[model samples]
Target: MLTQIQASFAVNALTVSMAGITTDLDTPATSVGTAITAGTFAMAAFILLGAKVGSRFGTRGVFQIAVAIHGLAMLGVALSVSPAMLFIAQASSGAVIALIAPALTVFIATNYHGAQQARAIGFLAAAIPAAGVLALILAGWFATTIGWRWSFVLMVALAGVNLVLSFLVKKVPAQPGLSIDWTGAIIAAVAVILLSFGFSGLATWGIWLATPQAPFDVLGISPAPLLVILGLVVGQVFFSWLRRRGREGKPRIFDLRVLATGSERAVTACMATMLFVGTAANFLIPLYIQVVQGRSSIETSFSIIPYTLSIFLASTFVAYLYGRFTPRLLATTGFIVVAAALTLLAFTVRGEWSQGFVVAGLILLGLGQGSIVALVFNTLLSAAPKQLAGDVGAWRGLVHNLSGSVGIAVASAFAVGMLSSMLLAGAQEHPEISDELIAQVNFNEANFLTNEQLAAVLESRASGPELDAAIAVNAEARLRALQISLLGLGAISLLAIVPATRMPGRREGDLPEKLEPDDDDVIDPVDEKETVA
Candidate 1:
């Protein structure tokens, strides 16, 4: 619970702090998004490696060390004065989290029985949004009062608490002789980095032809799509390599048995899709409130309270419905609600920080996303064998981070792309804004800014009338971009309903399957060791 809340604290603090950080670091919003992406991508890259390392050492030992290191990393975040430093700090925290994630499941599976385990899993899932509520209020206050830096400072204190509490967790035995799968780790890292960077570059690197912002191009074409294709191919290669290692009786990075069934795979896909949508919406909402509307952090928090509270309530209480509904029915209904909520948001949001209809949409969104988030884990954990609980946790962590990273990156790129095109077209059509002013601004960079930020960028290049015209164009463009993006996301969510139908099924009124922990899976709370193959 502590580790999961720590992870959520990092995300929530940084999330509400994006606008302030962008201003402080003198960088674009995408840079802030990249700092977030760096952390999430690191979570994906180091998860398997962390699992192997936990096995080599011991779960309890790794958990303690990771907690301590994360505290240090949170300190780094507090002191960071530049985008690069922020990225490094966040990435370090994320990598350390990978080591702690597997232990969460191990402790639960090793210590708890059937109903206790289900309740434990619900608490685990609920921790995220619960932390979000706390972080938002606290971070919002910090950002509006002292500074955004103090938000991370609080995390440093929390980390100490977690480190002390971690010792209470029961220890699990280790497989000291299980060699690390370095080959698979390398492949996985490459795939994730390629995908994350490629998605981020789509806004800067031209969608079709090469843009000056691109590092390099493939022939005359943009490298973004090429990199995305390469990432997909490399991902497939990683899976193929896993198959080969299994055939050869070599130590594989992941045990394929965790996802061997079609139901498991479908659950994973649904999880990814829901996370992708949820994270994207999370990113866009703050971006609009803080950057576009020029609201303070406290106001941002107030506006978002409805959403966060709804998620917390839904996640905590969704388990009770498990007895009355099948996982498939629950999941399909959840996705449908998600789609409706997003569509409502797309149509209702316009030129304001808060409105009755907008709050309604946010409430609906939280209920849908929170329930789905809790349900997928509940279903996966209940159905999978007890011995594989740690692996299931690692798998859930991987998908959560990867999908979330891509969601933010893609949303940033998409919104930026829309800003560029609409800004240009709006400029050309406006009577006051001249061609000279348009030529002066570097639209290729795709840095969407508020009226004040735009004026600073233009400096003396634009007269009052010209600047007003530009700002008018910019304001409308940003709004439309956000609206269109939300609609597209809604469409994607509706598509997920098809796959949700394929998730683990249960008879009406049937509780989720829960098995007793294997005798070998647990060890002495005092001291016990295992070196099994």
Candidate 2:
């Protein structure tokens, strides 16, 4: 269980760090948008497929296969030349996750029970965030020194290690004669692909009903909004198909019956919200350090050390709090703390603010997000039926992965949109500014400017004293653009509060009530039953 947990964390860390590096390499907002979409699409497809495969082959088999696939995919990403190749590699890696995640959950259920299972899952959950910190630090250093390719190479090596560890596990006997839902799989895949592409396009292109012409002509026509609509329609059809198949005694992609449980819904919601908050913070902070503060990649990664440490510390102790404190209280408090940190960050992002503010904010955010995530996963697994553990685990993974991807996507879109709007507003206010000047001013490097500096630059551009004023104005504008983007991200953090409220209050020692036998069952002499019943 520990090995699997560590492997899962390592895999996620590699993927996320690679994503951040890819954004840096492909500097434009459009590139970031596209990469996020491609990566997300690939992840969704892989997880769904992997779940089906696990059902047929058993957890260990699926896990080993995933490890191999992940290694190859990492290598492919490292060697990729074109954007298309990168997308393909990302999708393949995502597929690997699908295989491994369900298996990991099944393994936990099979090997451990009760509080031990909860603790193991908590530890496993913590591994991801912990690994993320490590990945970011490593990626920043490697990207700065050896280049992003080396990071991928490192990922391949980690995947190899995971493969070896996976082989050490004893295999569970496979469930015989399980059938795969091919049609449902195809529909789900298509829906995810279309939806990811559509959302990516929205982030790159304008989100208005009618597309604006200023951006590079995409497919010679705007396809974002259209694709989103198509995806929704396709998703509806997929769900209908699943329903029909269930009625026909054929296998279905999603077992909707499992979702009927309140605990299941709450757990899924909590995980989604946790991912949303955590990923949004992760997405923005690096940009804040590297671009706005003009920190080197290594420096930026180092800056996150406080956050990483806080997460590690917080995660380690959450298991102790379970049973003593309800998940609702812990999660709610976490969300509030995170929100407070974000709000503080928004206020402190001026020229006069110290680096300490940023570090403090990062630490708080990490502590809150890390605790909530660990707690939520532990609770969800405990709440689920033993027989349905694999399915529930897959569902949890699906929601978390999807939420993280969408959170980043939405955050990127919102930040970019706000930055663009602010830039345009500044430009309009200074009508004399040239397009070249505006282009220079529109650079979206994070951490490059303070709000006051940006305002001053806009003022100078409006006054038009000299060429130097123009340069200053451009620089300031670029800085302000980055600042506003951070603010947008901070605002998004508040959304987590709503879902956090829905979490149950159960703590670690509080055992859930076991299900009673159905009334039709004949009592065995060895079993004790209440005489009144």
Candidate 3:
């Protein structure tokens, strides 16, 4: 559970410290965004390898070593004075989390069984939001007060504690003879890294045409879209490799049986969709509060706490509803709720800070997103045998990291892109703002700046009514950008209903007081020879 918290904290705390990083390092927000994506990309790329390595070597030993390394990484983060150091330390922490995440899940399989396992998974889901809540409050405070570095100093101490406490977990049996599939590992890592990096870079490097910020261009086209295409192709190759290995009775980096059935595949899709929506929405809220409104860190915490608390509550208590509702039904309703919440937010969001309607929309989002998160994992884990626990965890981690990276990337790109278009359009149409003044301002490099930031930019170049109009346009543009992004994400959530319907449904009277142990749950995955669909 602490491992899950650490994973989530890596994202949330960095977000809270963005302002400090920009100020202290004399770097732009885009640079900070890149650092955050580097961590996420590392996690996505290395998670499957973590699972295989843990199975080849004992999970207990790997977990401890990873935790210790994570502590050192956090220590490095605390001392980082440049963007490169911050990036390296954060990426290292994310890479080690790839090891810890699967190890934690495998430990649950080793230590718990049946209903207890379901509850444990529920708690694991809950921990994600719990970390968000903690990050918002603590990271915000630390960033506001002493320094952002102190927050990492605190993480280093917690890592040390986690390392010591890891001794309590039961030893997971290791398979020394099971050779690590290096080919599959390389293919999978490349695919995930390309996808994660490509998605994240779309904001900076143009979505289609090459932007000024792109490192290189392919015949006037951006590398971002090309990378996404290549990632998809390589992903298909990884599946083909898996099929070959499964046919030859060779060990795979990931077990196909974990997602062998159509229902299981649907479960994975639903999980990713739920996480993407939640992560994107969660990211956008703080971004608007911090960047657009120029709010304080504690203010960000106060504004976001209710939403995070709602998610935490729903995730922890949602297991009680499992007996009454089917996973399919729960997932369908959850998507609906998420969509409705986003619609509410879109219609009600304004240029100002949090309003009553905005708070209501956030709470609705939290409840829906939280329920689906716990339900999907419980459904997926319950279907897989105990031996495949590590694979399930690795896949879950991959989705969690990839979806999070993509979600934030899409949100940033869409919001900033809309802001850029609207700002120029508003300037072109407005009677007060002159085209000459607009020419002086480079809309191409537009950021989610506050009125003060816009004012500072326009103050020296031009003054009076034209400057006011430009600032007003910026204010309206940034807010409308957020609204449009929310609307689009809401539409995607509604479309996710197609996948939700494909998830496994329970029979009319299949209600059990607890998710009790079944024969399939205890079966050894190696003995089962189900073909991958």
Candidate 4:
């Protein structure tokens, strides 16, 4: 549980520190965004290798080394003087998390069974939101008082504690004869990295069409979607290679046996959806508070507290309910709650921050998010045999990190596109304004700006009516873009219910199995229950 908490905290600590880093390094927001994107990319791209490495080497030995590496990365981050250094530090932390994730999951699977295992998984799930809350409070304070670098200092301390605690964990026997398929690993890494970069570029580059910021274009179309498409094609190739290895009795990066059933795939889908929505919301809310409202990081953190707290409390409570209710029932209910909350939030957004309605909506989202995360994760863990836990962890890491990147990218692109459209339409409304003035403001990109900055930009050239028109148009367009994005997020949540329904109707407690890798048959829920009887 501490291991999981450390991992999540490292991921989230940057949230409240973005402003400080940008200011101190004299860099644009994109640099900080790149740091985050690189970290997530590294984690998702290498997680399968991390799983296999844990199996090939000893889990405990690899875990300790990973934690040590992570601690060193945090120290590097604390001493970073430029955005380049920060990016490298963050990427290093990400690579280490790839190792820690599988080790922690395998530890839980090996050491616990049945209800105890379910509880442990629930605690792991709870740690994510709990860590978010802690990061916001502590990281926000550190960023505000000392510097953003000190937040990394905090992570270093936590990593040291986790390294010491790693020794206490049960040691699992390593598989001696497993050989890594370097070809498959390279293919998988390339596929995930391409997909992550594609999504990350969608906001700066165009989503469907080419933008001025695009590095290069294919004929005339944007390379973002092209990369995503190509990445998917390559991903299929990797899976085919895995299937061949499975048939030939050769070692593969991922354990193909864990994904043999529809239930397992469905659980993956649910986790991906939950993470996508959560990541999108987390990114957009801070952006609104800081960029639009001109609030401090602490203020942004305070604004999000209700959401984080709700997730932590709900996750802990819902774990107790897993033995009594089916995952399908719990997941279905959670999605409905999230969808409704997002709808309410979409309607409630305005130029003036509606604190009451926003808090209400966030709390509701927290409830559903907490429940789905804990319940679905437990379901996925319990579905697999104990020895395959590392594979399950790798799957979790891949889905989560990939979805997070996609969610942020899609939200950014959607909001930017809508804002551009709105700004162009508003500019058309005021034909009195000069084309040169429009170009100067770069209204096509439509970044949020304070009223004073807007006035300053127009003071030398234009006066009363044109300036007022520009300000009104920019404010309205920005708010509208945010609202539309929230609604789109709601639509994504509603769609997730389709996968949520595919979860097994049986409770997780009845589905525990102790099969080996050589077992050819799938663990049918009914058969497993009968065998336990």
TM-score per candidate, in order?
A: 0.84, 0.77, 0.89, 0.90
**Residues 1-533 of candidate 1: C-alpha lDDT, one tens digit per residue:** 76788888887788878878888999898887777777877887788778777877888888889989998999998998888898899989988888888888778777776556656777888889888888878887788789999988888898899888877778788778878899998998898778866776676786668888788987879898888889889989998998787766677777665675567777888999999999999989887887778887677777888898898788878888887888999999999999999999999987675588888999999999999998888787766655566678888988887787678778887888778788899899998999888887777675667778887877778868888888899888888888888998999999999889888676212222333223223222211111122
Per-residue lDDT tens digits for candidate 4, residues 443-501, read 55666566677678778877777878887877777777888888888888889899999
The per-prediction tally of clashing pairs is: 0, 14, 0, 0
Q: RMSD per prediction, one decimal? A: 5.9, 6.7, 4.1, 3.9
Clashing pairs in 3: none
The alpha-carbon lDDT assigned to residue 3 of candidate 4 equals 70
Error of 2 at 514 (Å): 8.8
lDDT at 531, model 1: 16
Q: State each model's CA lDDT, in order.
A: 0.81, 0.64, 0.83, 0.81
Q: What is the lDDT of residue 349 in candidate 3?
A: 76
Off by over 4 Å in 1: 14-37, 76-89, 143-150, 420-447, 451-473, 507-533
Q: Report the Cα lDDT for candidate 1.
A: 0.81
lDDT string, candidate 3, 14-66, tens digits? 88888898899888987877777777778788899999898888999998899
Give a tens-digit lDDT track for model 2, residues 1-533: 34444344444444445545456555444453454455556667656666667877777887787778878887887777766776677767666677777788777777766667667777777676566666766665665576767777877787778778776676877766778888888888888777766665665554543355324444555576677788889989987897677556666666654354454566677678767767777777766665556665566666777887788777767777765778878877877777777776766664332568866877887787778888887766666445456666777776776676667667776666655565566655664666666665534432234434555655644443434444454455555655565565555556655666665545433223332233322323222121111
Error of 4 at 255 (Å): 1.8
